[model samples]
Target chain A: MSSVAVIDYGMGNLHSIAKALQHADSSVAVRISADADVILAADRVVFPGVGAMRDCMQALNETGLAETIKTVAASKPLLGICLGMQAMLSDSEEGGITRCLNLFDGHVKRFAEGLADTEGNRLKIPHMGWNQVHYKPHPLWFNIPQDSRFYFVHSYYAAPDDAEVTVATSNYPQAFSCALAKNNIFAVQFHPEKSQTVGLQLLQNFLHWDGAL
Target chain B: MSLAKRIIPCLDVDNGRVVKGVKFVDIRDAGDPVEIARRYDREGADEITFLDITATHHNRDTMAHVVEQVAGEVFIPLTVGGGIRTLEDIRRMLNAGADKVGINSAAVFNPEFVRQAAEKFGSQCIVVAIDAKKVSAEGEKNRWEIFTHGGRKATGINAVEWAVRMQNYGAGEILLTSMDRDGTKSGFDLLLTRAISEAVSIPVIASGGVGNLEHLAEGIISGKADAVLAASIFHFAEYSIAQAKQYMQARGIEVRL
Candidate 1:
């Protein structure tokens, strides 16, 4: 009876992610919690978030789950999704320059104002909808195909200082790090729960992963 | 690759069952909302919109149940609309697992509701659905007028102007449906769609008359819609979602295939 704890820091779609995890593997026990003891006891930890980075950082600090998450990242397999992925970086330019968890050596940057494709049409800001991901060899990409489409809805992207931690890259107009992998930590800018088949495969892979470097 | 143009299949649920009709009249039973949603999810639908047509108090609970069931089965983004009057109602729908909540009549009656919802919840989860009809009068240039109450009552608000107002009020997306073209199956109201899409910076979903794959493509290529939402053509199995994606892909519109 493997258990996975989804850290709920008063942000993100905790329900959908919990349901997706259960849907990926019905046998795994999934729990959404903010308590440190419950999160620490789980075999794996998933940190998911939506909304602004300032609020997310405020909630994480207020709930004291920030320390718990850092402790879990040291020993167990830890996964972050969307804003959760951004929060793992050093800081973000959103909400008037907010500092983040700094779990990974990266900073979150807002998409430049006048971004456009090769055709020179003004691209929409949020960068909403499906985009393909180019990945390198990693446990999370075990069964998923190369250049698989995943759902993304964000105005900011993660720019890791050390390119070695980047596991996958996606492009809106220019390429950006979409997935980051280091030791027992894995994070993605796309919403795997909203992403259809390939997303479920990634969650299934995370469920079976052993938190290896 | 750019963000693929989305093709969304909408389910008009009444008392937990999906229903379809012409201009909100002569309704016919489609199927279980959950079942239809699951089928569409398997068929590669980019997103799903569940509009609860029932206005009764008891049915609100049933609508929530329907959303929960569909959300459990379908992993894509789900937008639930109809009878959402207050922040509590929006909270209920979202708590039931809906990713986005669409506001129409309530938004027209009280424009502040749009701002409040967008402020409480992130703008990304707030969608304003506009029902519009082409208005032609002597001397005045033709413009679309906004309609409410399931397209039964007409509001004097201009469609393009209202779309801009909604965006100013912090709405992330606009779902525009042409009352005249709805159920006619001729095609989407291209002029109305293009006007609103071009007017607002946010994404706009072209709804109403969608008879074929070409119409869907036209909504994106010509109308500049970020997404297309249809009911009857998909409800009757006249065309599968995969076929639509293939059609759009062959025509060089990026679609998830």
Candidate 2:
């Protein structure tokens, strides 16, 4: 059976993603491992995280998983989730200019304070709850429909330098990059494990995707 | 489209089973938290909240199991409230696959606990549940006070001010429950909801006293809450999560269909 390694650098939803992946496909074995060699040996890689960007980077660097992630991003089918997605960017403004993995050409920015919707209701920060994703064609999206709502809980969003790299966008007060795709790597700012049926479907798609353009 | 206001079906769990009676006539067991959670998830619930009212230490273990089971298959965000007093407690719930944990009385007793939990676990997972009651005279400037122990004890802290304090302390969201109207089935105290919602920069989930579908809509339009949480109305089959979303959509509020 094929297997995937969920890089566990001691931050974010480790057990949840592993279980969701197995639930998404029983044929695939999901392992949450920090060992660089064990992770690189897997068929695919899933980098998931929650919490602040700074602490996440600290753990990844200290555990030597940061180098492991860069190697995987360039070599195989890789999925980055939430803070994991943010860390793929060049740098994040969170915790005062924390350097990310720089896997993608983008910068993470915090949502401006006192933002409101068309109805003028003050939009809250951290952007918690469900939001619709307007996605472009990608193998990862598969059967997930356009404008499908996904769960989001973050204070900052990715601002990719190249518009072509952004595969999906969601609105808080303005359109922002919520999903990105490049050769061998697919990243999302939403939690597919926590997104219910459509989320599971996305995981299944990733399990089957061969990372070809 | 923009972010949709969330409609969450809250379950009061005790000893691992749903405390409140559920009216799912076709489901095998109405009291099973996992079953009810699955039902709600299928009905398009934006999120599911389990208000663990279990008091005994051993029974709390059962709730953890319940969360684990639900988190494995249910997929949507799950928040466990009640008796989450320590970092260890928060860690246990998160390890069990809970997306977040709600802190209530513990936040009132030691405000520092909220700060510590936020730092240790991240504010995104630390939800400060504020139970508030109207304390001012009918004609005077409206003011509400925080209550604890299921609204039986007053903390003498102002609700709006406390919301700001929690936000400053790094609470990601405020699960504000209006104790005055919790079970009244009348409606949410819109005054209380808007006050705290505006005071805090984080998301506010308006809870308590949701009698009908319109009350849920009212929560967003009038209360300015980012989300609405209800127990009896959803628990008793008064409305399904899909129907509530449609109602909010009709009222021109964005909701997941």
Candidate 3:
């Protein structure tokens, strides 16, 4: 049995994400402690958030979950959603410059420059809505459709320092990375739980992935 | 590349139950907000909004409790609205785990609340919801007017202008609902939607008039909205968020397919 510990850092909506994973037949547990034992025990870990990057980073630091999370991600599957995903970056410009989990070699940037379409049309910020992902070849894409829709709601986006880590991309003004995967670490800018069938299928795929089987 | 459009599911809560409909006809009773939200999450909704339609000048606690339940259960971002008249209301919602707090009639009545909440909670935490309707006169072109109180009270303010003003007040997002198209499922009000989208710098979630996936695509691509917000369609099982997104993807709307 693969036990997945959902990190509870006193931020984020953890119930809904847990329900989705539970629906996919994975044993879901909400883990809030920074203890090394609890994290090392889980077969997988989920970091979920819906607040500013600064506070999320602070919670992890205050609770010492930051170090524990990194250690857990080294051996088991780790997932980040929304702010959780954003925190995985090297740093974020939200509420002034702040350090991030730095799990992936990337930085979170605001949509300072207006997004221009390929034909030069201006697109607004806080990218909210259902967008398609041009899935890049990765282990997380296993058992998932070539092109699937995921739900996104955010003003800032992640720009990975390493292009090879980008697992999926979406177009809004221009193509931007929507999903990133490196070994057992994976993060999606979009919310798979809110995504419907394609979203649910993606969760199922992750549950049964077995790290590329 | 064009940014992808989003699919959002909204719930109208009255006394802690999900109640919805234009003019609120044939109100279908649903389960707890947390349960309904989880189902939507499992079904792959991009985001969720809880409109506390029962909100009035008093009774903010009920709405806060509902938000607390939904927030505690749902892992995705949750936006809560209704009866948010002051900065305190916004604070309660955020404390209860709301990713964003939406202001409607109150924003029209007290514009300062928008700025105050945004300043205290950050602009991203504030969302201004506008209910729009077309007023017509004999032999005259129809005009858009803003409505509040769950589409009960009509404000003299222009929908587009209000949207622009709300953004200036630090609204991170706008939830624009078309009263005429709501529950009709005919599709979104493209003209009004585009006008608001064009005027605001924040992301716009076009609500009302979403009957099918094509509507979702048109609501985003044609209306140029950041996301499409629908209720009856997704709630009544007319279509799941996945089907709608797939349809939008086929139409080249850049959905998460």
Candidate 4:
């Protein structure tokens, strides 16, 4: 039986992701594990988290899961969500400066203090709520309609150095890269677990994908 | 299209059942919280807020159960509000699958608690719910103050100032409810909504007194709310979420249709 492991590094809740994975494909054995072996042994790994980059890096490095994540990224079909996606980047500007896994060459940045649309109204930070994700052809977009709206709640966004790695983008007044793909890895700033039907479809696609282009 | 303005349906849950109390009183049964949440999801609601209005200590767990059941099937952002007092409470709700937990009276009693909650859980999950009532005399310059105990007692805290304070204290978003217009169905207090929304950089969810689709649009256009929340207009089948979205879309409000 195929099994999927959701990395639990003492950051963010694993309940939603685990449940969503199981809900996506009931046949897949889904487990939330903090142990390295459990994740390495699984067919797929889903890395997810929330909160400050400093704190997340603190927990990950302290638990030595940072190394585990780095190792897994080299060998498995890994998926990252929200802060997990940010963590995949080289570093972040949050909390002065915090180095990340560096699996992806990029920096996570904070939305500027005063972001306004054409109407001159100040756009709220955290970029909370649903926004449309425009995607190009990719395995993860298997069944999700192009430009489908997904739930998002974050203060920072991934800005990959290599634009070719970006597969999808979303606009919070200005376009920002929201999804990326690079051999054996896929990551998103939006929460697929909380994005309704299209989200589940993406997860299903991830589950069936074998890390091939 | 840009980010769609969210249309959230507030489900006041009491002991596992969905109920809507007019202005926080005159409680009446709506239906199962899970069922109502599912219907809202199917109808294309941007997100769902389950306000646990349950009073008894023993019955509080019912809200978690409701969230757990809904979270498994309904794959949209679910926010649980009402009676969230501590870090443990926030953790419990998050563990049960709530994307966000709303803090109300506890914030007014101890402002620092908001900071602690945000620090521990991250501001993204810490939503400070503000219940504001207009206190100024009709002829006088407009002023609103915080009210606790279901909007009964005035706290003398200025509403707009409180919103900015909470945001500074690390609240990710503000759920602003106009006490005067809550159940009156008159409409949102555009002035109050605009004041608090403009004061804070965090997203403000304009809630209370949503009688029709136009009111929803007004909340975004005039009130400047990042999102608009309503209850009875949806709970009683007065209008579906799709209908509300269409109305907002027609008015060029940018809904996820």
Candidate 5:
């Protein structure tokens, strides 16, 4: 069995994430251990959450999983999700200014002005429900569609400093980064786990990633 | 870019089991609500609304345990309606892992319930449900009146005005059901649906009278609804959300397939 470790840092929605990985035929183990060896030895590590950015980062710091996560991300495949994805950015505007995991070079911010003056395009905030994701040119674009819908439930989104890292984009008010990929690290603004077959395929692709350069 | 439309699946629960009937009679076991919910979650359902038909008569709060179980298994957003009358009801639903709460009779009796719940939980968490019947007359001009208590009482309030009032009261969305067309399997009331959709700035979910995938697509396009919700077609496995979405995408509607 291919052992996949899903880091549970006092965040919600771990069960569904684990179930999704298992559905993709990967053996998932929910882990909160600060022990470096356990994380370092896993085939892949998934960081998942469904809560405030500050509380998640706090849990990571308190459990000392922060160092374990950093160490593992440098050497192995590490995936951050939702708040976990936001935590990968440099910082967030949620709950005042706070430091994030800094796995990537970016800051997360709230949607501006809540009013997009586009004709017939009035939408609510939180950007809840399914939206189309447009893939940028990258190795991660192997089997994903050019225009596919993914589930999104976020109030703030990633604003990466380096444009080159963005692997896919989606338009809410205007186009924004939906997924980022740089070396062994990748994150999506949308929840692939909840995105059904297309999402399952993404997970399968991640599990079978050859890291071909 | 045009705002993408939503496709939602509604499950009607009676005494913890999903029951199906025509014209709201001769109820039979449809399926387990949790199983059906998980299937819809896998079928790429945009969002889910669970309506507990017996909630008021049973004298219970909203079905929190079911919400908890479904939330544990499914990661998508869940909205629970039925017997939601107070702020505590909204809080309970949210605590049970529901992302949004739907209001009907409570909002009809007291519009302040809409304002209060929206204030307590944020406007995005509140959904005002309206059951409407068309008033047919030349001067009536495609008007719809709101119905309450399982479509038993006619409020005589114009559905469009109520939609506008709910929008002003901080409702994030509206679930409009056509009482006349419900369970008839004809198709959604597009004229009445369009009127409510046009009157409100918030997202509108068109419910009732969806018999096939084309109805779902047409509901979104013709009715100008953000989402088209159906019960029988989905409950009886006549069509899946994926199939409906594919049909919509084929018809040039931007659906997340």
Candidate 6:
């Protein structure tokens, strides 16, 4: 039986993600584990997190899962969700610019304060709610339609130095990279577990993906 | 593109079953809470709010089970409220698969609970539900007052001021409900809804008195609410969530269509 490990680094809604994965494909075995052995042995790895970058990095560093994640990223298909996506970058501006995993060449940035649309109405921070995701050809976007709506709830977003890694973009008044992909790694700023139908399709795609670029 | 204005269908669960009533009285059984939630999700509900009206310790486990079941089938965000008093309670709900936990009476009685919950589990998962009623007592200017205990007890706190306080205390969103307009279906308390929405920077979900799709649109255009929550209209299948989204989309409001 195929097994997928959802890394639990003392952050994120591990239960919700695990349940969503099982629901996405009932045959796949989904396990929420922090142990390195469990993660390495699984056919795929999903890194999911939320909250401040400082605490996220703190928990990851303290638990030594940082090294385990990097080790697994080299061979297996790895998917990062929300903060997990941001953490894959070099650093973040949150909490006085904390450094991140640096798996991909990028930086996480906070949405500029006082941002507004053309109508001059101030946009709320956290960018909470559904926004359309425009994607390029990729395995994760296999069956999902173009410009599909996904749920997003974050104040900061990933800005990769190399635009080649960007797989999808979304507009929060301005376009930002919502999904990034390089070789075996795939990451998204939106919450697929909370994104309904299209999201489940993406998760299902990830389950069958072979970690190819 | 702008953030879509959300239309949330709320399920008032009592002992694991969905129930609806007028002004929180003469309650009638609607259906299974999880099944109703699943239906709303498929029909294009922006989100779902589950309020445990019974609020008893004995039924807490049952509520969690319902949340687990709903969370498994429904992919949209779920906010569970009622009888949430402590941080542990919030943690329990989130662990049980709820995306967000809505605190009402506990937050009014002890404002610090809001701060602590926000601090512990990011504000995104912490929603403060305020049940407010307009006070037009002699010599006092018209002001909405906060009510607790399922809108039975009144607190002298000003609704708008309390909303601001909750935002300042690190609440990510405010679920503002008008007690007077709740079951009346006359229309939302636009005055009260607008007051709280304008008072806080965080997202405000206007609740109560939604009789039709136009009322939902008014909640966004007139009340300035980021989202609108309704129970009866949806519970009885009077109007599907897709119809409401189509109505709002026609009115130039961005909805997930």
Q: What is the per-residue lDDT of model 5 for residues A1-213, given as tens digits with 9 covering 90 to 100?
A: 566788866666455576677777645444543456777778788877766677778888998888888887787777777778888899999889889989889999987744543545345555666778888766555687877777776778999999998888888778888898888887888777777667777777776665432
| Candidate 5 chain A lDDT trough over 10 residues, lowest sum | A113-122
Report the C-alpha displacement of residue A38, candidate 5, in angstroms.
7.9
**Candidate with maximal lDDT:** 2
DockQ of 3: 0.28
Which runs of model 1 end up more than 4 angstroms from their true locations?
B21-30, B136-142
For candidate 2, chain B by itself scores a TM value of 0.98
In angstroms, give how far residue A69 of model 6 lies from its true place. 1.2
Model 4: TM-score, first chain: 0.98
Q: Model 4, range A97-200, lDDT digits (tens) per residue?
A: 89999999999999988989888889889898889999978988997888999989999999999999999999988899999999999999999998888899
- Model 5 residue runs over 4 Å out of place are A1-12, A32-44, A51-75, A93-99, A112-119, A136-143, A207-213, B1-4, B21-48, B56-79, B83-147, B153-173, B178-181, B184-202, B211-215, B236-243
Residues B1-257 of candidate 3: C-alpha lDDT, one tens digit per residue: 34466677998887777774332122233546666777777666667888887786444677677766765556566888877877777777776767788888778889998888776666767889899998766577656899876677888888888898899888889999999898787999998898888778788889998888788888877788888898888777777778887787788765543
The candidate 5 chain B region of ten consecutive residues with least summed lDDT is B21-30
Interface RMSD values, listed in order for every candidate: 1.2, 0.9, 4.3, 0.9, 4.2, 1.2
Model 6, span A1-213: residue lDDT tens: 899999998885788899889989999999999999999999999999988899999999999999998998899999999999999999999999898999999899988877766765557776889999999899899889899899999989999999999999998889999999999999999999999999899999999999985
User: Model 1 over residues B55-110: C-alpha lDDT tens digits?
Assistant: 57787899989888877767889889888899999888888888889999989989
- Model 4, B14-83: lDDT tens digits are 8887765322112233467766777788889988999878645666688888899998898888899988
User: Native-contact fraction for each model?
Assistant: 0.45, 0.92, 0.42, 0.91, 0.21, 0.60
lDDT of 5 at A53: 76
Ranking by DockQ: 4, 2, 6, 1, 3, 5
lDDT of 1 at A78: 96
* Candidate 2 residue-wise lDDT at A128: 89
Top model by TM-score, which number? Answer: 2
* Model 1 Cα lDDT, one tens digit per residue, A1-213: 999999988774578888889999999999999999999999999999888899999999999988998998889999999999999999999999999999898789999866666665567667788899999999899889999999988889999999999999998888999999999999999988899889989999999999885
Candidate 2 per-residue lDDT, tens place, B89-207, comes to 89988999898999989999999999999998898998899999999998999999998878898889999999999999999999999999999999999999999988888999999
Q: Compose the digit string of candidate 3's lDDT tens values, residues A1-213.
A: 567777887774455576677766645444443456776787777777776778888889998888888887777788888888888889999889889888888889887656566644456766765666888677666666766666677888899999988888887756787888888888898887655566666777776565542
Clash pairs, candidate 6, are: none
> Considering TM-score, which of the candidate structures 3 and 4 is the better prediction for this target?
4
